[model samples]
Target chain A: MPEKPSVRAVLLGALPFLAMCFSVPLWDRIDPIVLGMPFNFFWLVLWIPLSSLCLWMAYRVDRHRR
Target chain B: MRSSLLPIGIISAIVLLGSGIGLLAGSRRKMDLEQWTVGGRGFGLILVWLLMAGEVYTTFSFLGASGWAYSRGAPALYILAYITLGYVVSFFILPPIWEMGRKFSLQTQSDFFETRYQSKALAALVSLSSVAFLIPYLEIQIAGLGIIAQISSFDRIGRAPAMIIAVALVAAFVFAGGIRAVAWVSILKDALMIFAALAVGIGVPYIYFGGIGPMFSALAHTRPAHLVMPGATANMGHAWYISTVLLTSLGFYMWPHTFAAAFTARSAAVLRRNAIVMPLYTLSLVFIFFTGFTALLVVPGLANGDLALFTLVRKAFPNWFLGLIGGAGALTAMVPAAILLLTAATLFAKNVYRPLFAPAMSESQIARLARAMVIVLGLLTLYFAIYSSTTLVSLLLLGYAGVTQFFPGIVLGLYSNRVTKSAVFAGLLTGLLTLCFLMFSNHDPFLGINAGFFALCLNFTVTFVLIRGQKKNRLLSIPTTPRSTPK
Candidate 1:
């Protein structure tokens, strides 16, 4: 039988969709607060690498745990 | 025209040449058919993540998402919404797939079906359906590459040359390296895509409105309808948004290439990690979404929103920056094109050539056959790209609907052991026939839902009924292979 779906899994899984939900509103707020860069530009550049970092960490956790 | 020629040629040369190096590097490695096809059945977390990212985020996401945002108004957000949900769906589905792959040493999705149902015929059907759908899909990527080259060159290069050159370069790497070459090149492609998307997402709003908040507020004032939920138009509505999310979420895992990555994971945990953080890729879309809004804000009479991104890039950036962005965008198309070509080649070799022509062929012989198929498939897509009138999005969706026909065979093979080999074959045949009928007839069964979504509906229904009857007849499933401990 499949194990119970965890809260962590659910949160991680839903993050992208949730981001889609709040993206416009998030853009509205972050747009003005950039460090001389456009918020959209800052957001993706920061988030993509950051996301890559998270995936890397998750990979580590899974590997170490195994 | 001559001035732009240098930029276009430079960009194309860099991507093509870099990928060529990667191809040589891959071929030089002591790799076999298994390694080339499934990365030696033990791809580490990073490589797996990069490869999966390469497969999922294509020129389609770049062009289709932004174009949807531009043309459909509010409903365009559904592109982001559905893709995010799709990864979430993958988290649950992939674990068992990984375990199954490990236990059986499965190389392809159809191999899984073949073993589970004990049916070579069902495996053949899945392979045939996948190759058929994937060819058109590969053509769409080639088409997208041609479009970017055309736009970036500012018409300095003709369309036919662009298509031929792009196809030839992709075939070169794919024929040389296989999965290793694709994975390495994808990292570069992803970086460029993220950078370019970030540039467009932020640059347009910042230059146009001083900031994003003010940008939206400006849009709100000019066309508040576009600003609000359900968007700025009467045609876009809540139903379309919700249904698109539903369709894409379920259909995401249906693609053969996505499953092809499963056989490569070093561990089941890698698959989970990929699913957990994959959503962050959606961050790239925020800018694409903003770019769509930028179209609404700045470009008037914008019937085509996809052009909004390229137009903004050409208008704002210097030649060097535009050249870099064009190279990056071209990489987005090229990386996927390599993978698709490789995958179609593998499918043809394993399912078609091996069974029909070389029944006693060794692994190396099969690998050689796969390489030959890749070259042939690449040429075919090049021909179609040059001659066909089909737009990128249309060709993509047509391929998608056809591929999604495999959903039933895939799902039942994993979840229920009771699905008979004959029952599974019948279901697949019926599903494929129904999908082809609806697609060719232009009769979308699920009110405004795409053809793929409609086919998934029929595929699941028939598969469910067939499995239920098989179970009643005591045609129980053979037990799945025991899960192996991760090395």
Candidate 2:
């Protein structure tokens, strides 16, 4: 096991968590320009890709580092 | 009321039949306490997922979500926010916990404390605090079961009897099968729940509003503006909403059963994979919130809005569909109730009973004590359920705030080796006391979100200050060195 959670892994892990966290605030700002979706809806949908990408990146980094 | 007897009886019978089967099936695995309490620490990934899913998705998701939507309008979306965010937060948190559990052979939260801090008193302190926090939490689940039973059976069974029956079935399965039974039952429970939630979430809107657009349009017309967005109401100010979300997200993993399940994961990879996929499962909750909102449009002037989901379903659907949903609701309540009562029992047995009263106790004896305590705790929850006057949403929020008190110890203790036991203890105590005072006082800002968040804030601050002052304690020993042999 790595002695510390990889910095890359931490960053990857933080992406979905932080995105979900700031979703309410972030959506409020972009709601005006972000098409027809409500900030909440945008928050939920944006998570789909971010979560997917984070998981993918997490895997790639773990494999590359190994 | 006179027309409701058969449905209530049928739900009771279904619950009993499921519990009985789970009991008998899991009995063989109950040879030792560790097996009974923690499933021999080798529960497969599928079982772990079911167990995790069961714990996360409870009556709160089913009934409480709808109730909030029906009564409070759009702010109920926070339920969806917290539940989904909780799992994602766990992805980063659980691997370290699982690795530590494997290395230390930890069984309970207290066990982890004991090993990490080398302090039995601290372990005992956590056990006591956890039990105090979790009993009410378990009681809420029991109370939830009672509410669902009443709703499903159309109130044929009164709250008191329903509580008794609910608690009895849970106790029987937990006493017989232990964690193995809870997990197996959770699979069926979760499947039925997802199916039922979707059936109601999708079916109701379609039947009542004809589709999603019409449903939203109806809500837009009727409900107040604050229900939709943060800035809409003074009650949902941006700072408070964001803070509430932060508090809940941080505290999500602090629930006792969550910790217990983390220790049972087959590998760290399984946990990360599970967290990634789990949020998608939250699509069911989108339906849940829709069900709540649709209830607002269809059923106006509800006296007890908590029953809005059931009220709307009964209004929109026929008897058989109601029966199907009723069964699903029972599954939702039972799966988590079983895990919770069992986890509480294990906490009491391993942390409190064995350590304080029976340090010489064998693993088998400890297992027996745990099983017995499950029954005792289950019955106690029944008593609370029967007596509880709190609304479903209030019960859930109160439980969240109570459970979140453990956040400081569990999360920060993992990554930061400098988190001294004294600092953690002081921090947790300060947070928990503040939370209790706030909970009892019913402080401002719309019951002003539970003390869990505020408590967490103080707890972290104290831990930080304490950690900084203790320079000698900052050696940062790796509790579970990566290359070290698993205990």
Highest-TM-score candidate: 2
Q: Where does candidate 1 chain B have its weakest 10-residue lDDT segment? A: B478-487
Report the C-alpha displacement of residue B326, candidate 1, in angstroms.
Answer: 0.5
In model 2, the runs with Cα more than 4 Å from the true position are A26-39, A45-49, A64-66, B1-13, B224-227, B230-234, B391-399, B444-450, B473-479, B482-487
- TM-scores of the candidates are 0.86, 0.91
Determine the iRMS, in angstroms, of model 1: 6.2
Kindly report, for each predicted structure in the order presented, the TM-score of its chain A compared with the true chain A: 0.52, 0.66
> What tens-digit string does per-residue lDDT give for candidate 1 at B1-487?
3369666866877687658756775876776788888988778878988888888888878877777666655566566566666666676678778777777778777777777777777788788878877878888788777878888888886778877887787888877777888888888888888998898888878888877667766665676555434565554454444455666676787777888888888877778777767877777877777777776667767666667777777777777777787888788888888888888888889877787677798888888889888889988988888887755445466666666566666666666556677766776677677766776776653465455666667767777787676646577546565334333
Model 2: residue B279 alpha-carbon error in angstroms = 1.0
For candidate 1, give the lDDT of residue B452: 60
DockQ, each predicted model: 0.17, 0.34
lDDT of 1 by residue, A1-66 (tens): 223344454455445444443354454222353654344334434544444444454444444433
List model 2 lDDT by residue over B1-487, tens digit each.
3356556555656676678767775766535776776777786668778888888888878887788777775466666666677776787788778878888888777787788777788788778877776777677777776677777677666778877877788888878888788888776677778888888888888888787666665555554373455423456655566677778877788777888788877788878777777777777877787788788778878887778898888788766667667777877888888888888888898889888888999877787788778878877777667767655435456667766767777776776766788888888778777876776677623345435677777888998898888988365464666443322
Prediction RMSDs, each to the true structure: 4.7, 3.4
Model 2 TM-score (2 dp): 0.91
| Predicted complex 2: CAPRI docking category | acceptable
